[model samples]
Target: MSESEQLMVVDEAGQPLYTATRQDVHTQGLWHETFHCFVIDSIKQQVVLQQRADQKKDFPGMLDITAAGHLLAGESVADGVRELEEEIGLVKSFEELHGLGVYQEELRLPGFIDRERIHLFLTDSAKPLTGYSLQTTEVRRLLAFSFAEFARLAEEETTVLTTVEGETIQRNQFVPHPTDYWKTVYAGIKAYCER
Candidate 1:
């Protein structure tokens, strides 16, 4: 098991309050900062997604963002760029990322209380599927979906056939983020591509 990490706790308004261990933050429902990155291959109209490792404590075995992780105590949002390299072996400078804005979300479950302010970003990558080096402990594999198909499934809230690691899968296999969240992410990437 991985040791608990220290995180910078914040208030509803996103002001830093204090520091606490990752376990305590989730257990107490404290708000914390997190970074989320979405990789889009606009030219190919595809988005990269990662399947969370089954051993993960939260949302294990779920398909999630291209890269995401918490901000350690005393670290700024820019420091979060490390997640790209750590989780998916994508080394990118902060300047290379396009900020998509922060989103606040709270999820309460039986043994988890996750309140997070997510600093979202969008990046363009033409790298092939085989180029990513998966952190076996955090991510299991990588997959891609066309923007059109993603929007269609998100709008219908229904599953669609897709490919994952050369295997056919359903779109609902993704993390169950709120529909609006998916819309916002889609719009962000669409706008970026348009620019």
Candidate 2:
């Protein structure tokens, strides 16, 4: 229940249920949907990461995918292409996106158990980062990090991820995560980059 985000209903088997407030099914630990887009380098060795805006409901400004947003109610996963543009000002089409498989995971934090079905995609944009208009409320800053550096942060627990506006968030120990599902997304992207 982020005011900017939409809520949806789903079946017991995880199909679309209906749209509801975050307070409704959220208490029951059901899953939701999101769209993730990672902007990588030409060689695909680096990823453009965004710090979440300080105003977000979760994680806020911690290191996250290149660009991500909730899939609004009644929206298609394909619509995420537009979200990437609207949120980050990167106008592109599906061809630029290398659709990774949809991923599902559970998140535990601050008295909330968030289950999410994430639609992931990857693309390399040589576009200048400066030319983009940022959705300041959703992203505060952008940084490009090397895969090696990201690995070191996660492995060594050295990198302290904060929202683009500089709000820190404590993470779960059992998952060994840096920021939410970063480790999972990074592992997948790193594997993709290596090959």
Candidate 3:
């Protein structure tokens, strides 16, 4: 089934309520569960970011999470590991992921209201950017950025730039995740890297 047609376990303002189609959930501004993974290369102290496919209905052509997707109805958070492979072609087990806890996030677009109880995770990888096999329909390409530099960008109010894939990448180039969201991400990956 297409992602938009898939069944999602709905939440009413963070409380589990019922099941609805992905389309219904977003159009109605209902809450839903989502999985977000940040792939880090500890040896290189960098993290991978995927450029969403231009054809995507939401956030198309924008640099976003390393891998992320909504959880289907009846699926546990652990089941989200499939997204890692499906979106970026990195096969990994659930036990290999470091839990970063769940976060409440909401996005208000012109026609889309996305409220997600995001189950965040972090995983270490040493593979080069070329090692990833992009799911062309979902992700356009992957770029690696310095972990420390990314954290700085997330924590600071001023503009920060980092070289990614031979091009300069700044805060505006990414999806506008709230500052608190990025701080949680930075702290999670930083703690994981130090472990």
Candidate 4:
């Protein structure tokens, strides 16, 4: 982890209070801003997901959003578009993303406390899975699954299978987030795809 990276610490109301090192932000339980980008291939009715690198400090080896990263202390939400290029090598303009609005999430564990205002965005990428230039240190592989299958899994149905780097994976391999969060994101992306 980069302890020297500066992050904007926010209050409970999501107002920026001050700047702190990334280490302090997590160690002190301070709220911060993060960007989440979900890629949907509307024509194929599939959503792209990424396997976090096994060496990642957080959620290592778990399936996660297509791309995500924290915004630096002086960065604007629009500036976060860089994360997609940096993490997954998908270079996209801010205008290409469909804004899904900001949401707050708080998770507390033994040694981690994350309180984040997530700025979500969606993009329709028709590129082949093999086209992505993976940042090996942050991402392991990319996978795609039918949006409908994901919806069923979100509803607690067992045995959702997805193809990851040519192999099949089960639902247990995914990051276990609240069902409501999954449903909300699914609904949002579905609506966007339909439009």
Candidate 5:
């Protein structure tokens, strides 16, 4: 859908308020729902990360969650699983995912006001990097990082020398999600992996 045509159900303090186009939502800093999924390889203790396509308007060429997108207006939260298939070609049903709970994140960047109620999910997979067929317009590449290192990375603002795909990743290269969001995600992933 085109930016102006893509509609989202905006909210106020997590309560649904009204519908707005994607452009309007961001431009106005309206609260909207988004889906985030973290693909983990339990056996290898690695977490999958996607490099955002440079053409992206926000945080282009940065590391981010495995797959994510805004929830369309009238779309059920469970329907968010489509993001997995759309971004990385990794298909799975909603039932197969482990819920990490919803999180609230906000950031004001220049003219963009981002206030989001995010539905986070986690799934452990043994799939290799080459197994993913990335949507080049949304994601540039996919790589796996040590799960332990990722957890540490989320805990603080320091950059760690983590090599993936023969390239080193620094904290500056990641989307600057709030510390609380990272903490919640880390806790959820830890609990899920331990289970």
Candidate 6:
């Protein structure tokens, strides 16, 4: 799908502003939940990371919080578990994932306000990515980097780092979360791994 095409929005803004899903836009807002994962390999002290697909409409090709995706309108947080399995082929149960917490953020554009609450999780899976499906539509590449490297890269605003892909990070400069969220998560994970 082209990046400009919204899943649930009207092309021509009219009175009362109806959603593309044929619902009252004002009465019904798009509710979203994304799974933000920081797959860790406690044994190796590494974290699994993906370079988002450049074609992605939002945050294209940025170094991001491991595997993440929005929960479809009808999907539940439990379904997010399936997404992790499908996107990265990790055979894990919900109990295996540690609930890091929820992150709510507002991404406002001229006429678009995407207010989202993401369900964050963490897991330890040091397995290699050789047999993993790339899900080209959403993911461009996968590489495991040390948690310290992630902390370093995210500590500084908009920096380039090498992936296990060896691509020299051709696209998407990763920036720190303005609220120090990433750093905090990193510290927590580091401590857990240390234990």
The candidate that wins on TM-score is 5
Which regions in candidate 6 have their CA more than 4 angstroms from the true location? 1-31, 109-112, 162-172, 175-179
Model 4, 62-134: lDDT tens per residue? Answer: 9989999999988999998988998899999999999988878877777878888889898999998899999
Instruction: Write one digit per residue (lDDT tens) for candidate 1, span 1-195.
Output: 233878989998889989999999988999999999998888888989899999987788888899998999999999999999998899899999999999888888887888999999988899987899989999998888888766654575566646523466666677767767778888898889888
lDDT of model number 4: 0.85
lDDT of 5 by residue, 10-129 (tens): 665567777888889888888899999999888888889899999998999998999999888888889999999999999999999999888988899998998888999998789999
RMSD of each: 1.9, 4.7, 1.9, 1.9, 1.6, 6.5
Distance (Å) between predicted and true CA of 188, model 2? 3.8
Each candidate structure's count of clashing pairs: 0, 6, 0, 0, 0, 0
- How high is the CA lDDT of each candidate model? 0.85, 0.67, 0.84, 0.85, 0.85, 0.62
> Candidate 5 has which clashing residue pairs, if any?
none
What tens-digit string does per-residue lDDT give for candidate 2 at 45-162? Answer: 6667776778876677565666776677888888878867877888889777887777776667666766778788888776656777888988876766666555544554554433
Worst lDDT run of 10 residues, candidate 3, spans 1-10
Sequence-dependent TM-score of model 4? 0.91
To one decimal, what is the Cα RMSD in angstroms of model 2 from the true structure? 4.7
Q: Is candidate 4 or candidate 5 better by TM-score?
A: 5
Could you tell me which residue pairs clash in candidate 6?
none
| Worst 10 contiguous positions by lDDT, candidate 6 | 10-19
